[model samples]
Target chain A: MTLETNRQLEDLVAKAKSGNKAAYSEIVRMMMRPVIALTHRMVRDREAAIDLAQDTFVTAWEKLSSFRGDSKFETWLFTIATNKSINYLNSAARRTTERLDDVTVSRVSNSNPEDDMLQGELRSGVMEFMKGLPGQQRAVFNLRFYHQMTFEEISNALGKALGTVKTHYREAVKKLREHALAKGWTP
Target chain B: MNCRECQDELLLYGGVEALPEELSNHLDSCEACRRYLDEISEIAARFRADSDLVSESVDVERFVEGVEARIGRSRVDRLPAVTWVRHVAYAASILLVAGIMSVGLRYVDRDSPVNGVPPSTDQDYYAEEELDEGVVDIVISDFSSRGFLEAGDELLNDVTEDELKYLEENFDVRNLLL
Candidate 1:
């Protein structure tokens, strides 16, 4: 982000900390999509992702006082979202009981009926392949490709070594490639 | 670069990262490596395209409204139950401690030997009997021991000797002995 955008976010954070609900609401608006996307990719459940995203914001609002502004607000937000997603993924009950289905995909997609159906199939396929990845590797892949995060940034967010983050990203890509090849999806 | 080195660099190349000149040159000369790179690129592209599509298709307004509703409900639901339980537990603990202390203080004050005087030491009080052989025998059993005798004697100190003898004759010694 640019310096100006950073300043704007810090100003909003300051306002929200001072009990400005509007500012907090605006922060939620700004962060909701990425948070939901991150969670959806990790949990592979739309309703759970939406719930987790909302919970992330709620928790952030509750603990906003501890946010020292040491890192970017987006980084702090992403860390919370990531941890929540990983937690949901790690929960055995949720993993075993909550299978991805077409209904969930259709409900989450806002496209036209036909497009929604096709996109839902494609998304489920992608999610199925992604499920083969370990949670951390999948997280790395999603954060890098979907959110366009730098490896260094991901390392800081995950509290892992830079080399480790790179390895995860590489392994994620290699696994996806292998899956794609196995299914004859290569272009 | 060899095929292994080329394969290792495929992901980095597919991600468009700057690579060593040797790897770049190998990719330029190698069709197999190029095909592998294309496959990785295709997979990455597919992921990116799907991500973008999903991003555009999410309902932002619905999500924001849901979050607002949850936050409102949480604010209302969270505080009362926790505060009530905490206060109830605190009050119960205080009441329990007060009741114990009150009963303990009453027992100690009522059982003390002399009025406004602390109970006597163990060696200062004893129940003794003189046999026909003129031997003094001290009863050291717990119920007849020094502290029990002090408390019992303090309770009976004002009684007449005849009354004390009558009470002792009427009281069942077996229960106290057990």
Candidate 2:
């Protein structure tokens, strides 16, 4: 979808490629929020989200030569983000990375600590439930529900078949619905 | 299209791309499909809201600068050609220093040459001088053993008492013969 001006984006990309500081900075400014948002949803940790976003841009810069303007720059950017996010998730899973304990500890320190506690509990419950999902399903759910990516966009970004992406998303939604319902969320 | 097909394509519709006027008009006209479309749109809006629920504003300037700095540092790190030149210059410097040291050492303390390069101390000079004296003595001994035996006898007898005593103390002819 033509969300933004393609000619403007093309100009920005060209200027960035030429080592123009202002152009590069502008590109980062525009892409950072969406990237951070996507990573935050994918990993479900703000700090980790920031790290993942930074890593994503670093990787993109290094591999910028491979970006052949075949798709929208944002699409291409998100595609890089998707691969990086998935790889991060897989690597963290393989290494058995633990959830943030500080979030639990700090739950009692907020001004309205009860609200914080409830939110924290809900967040932890959802995260734990999400952890049980298969990798591709989890990714699809995060992209679809959290990043607001369409099935076709997600399919393109992940380099997966459209059917496969849709299937994973459907399965993810089904699993999440089951989990939420079991946890006493009103249907 | 059937409701199922329309449901499947609803997400693409939500993205608000250039849709055919006929499909748009159909969604507007059909109550059942419109209800389905509204539900899908509601779900999408909820997701959009969730995506927008960012707690903090990202430091875009800092982040961009940080990434740019990182890229710059990495580029600097890849100065292989410069590194090679520096390394060669370093090696040349060391070799030059060693060559200067060797030349200075020879000039400061003359002695018998080593590989055509002179020794580097007074002690070495004296040691080499002694070595030359020993060689001369050996050559004389070899001559005496063959047919130059009378030369040593005449030289020993021809010397004065003080001179002979000095020669004996320094060379020790009796010890040498043994």
Relative to the unseen true structure, what is the C-alpha lDDT of residue A114 in candidate 1, on a scale of 0 to 100? Answer: 81
- How close to the true structure is residue B124 of candidate 1, measured as C-alpha lDDT? 28
Q: Superposing all C-alpha atoms, what RMSD in Å does each candidate have to the true structure?
A: 9.5, 11.8
Model 1: residues >4 Å from true position, as ranges? A1-7, A104-121, B1-6, B9-13, B16-38, B52-59, B69-178
Give the CA lDDT, 0 to 100, for residue A150 in model 1. 72
lDDT on C-alpha atoms for all candidate structures: 0.72, 0.64
Candidate 1, position B145, lDDT: 55
Q: What is the TM-score of chain B alone in each candidate?
A: 0.41, 0.35
Model number with the top lDDT: 1
Worst lDDT 10-window in candidate 2 chain A: A101-110
Task: Assign candidate 1 its CAPRI class.
Answer: acceptable
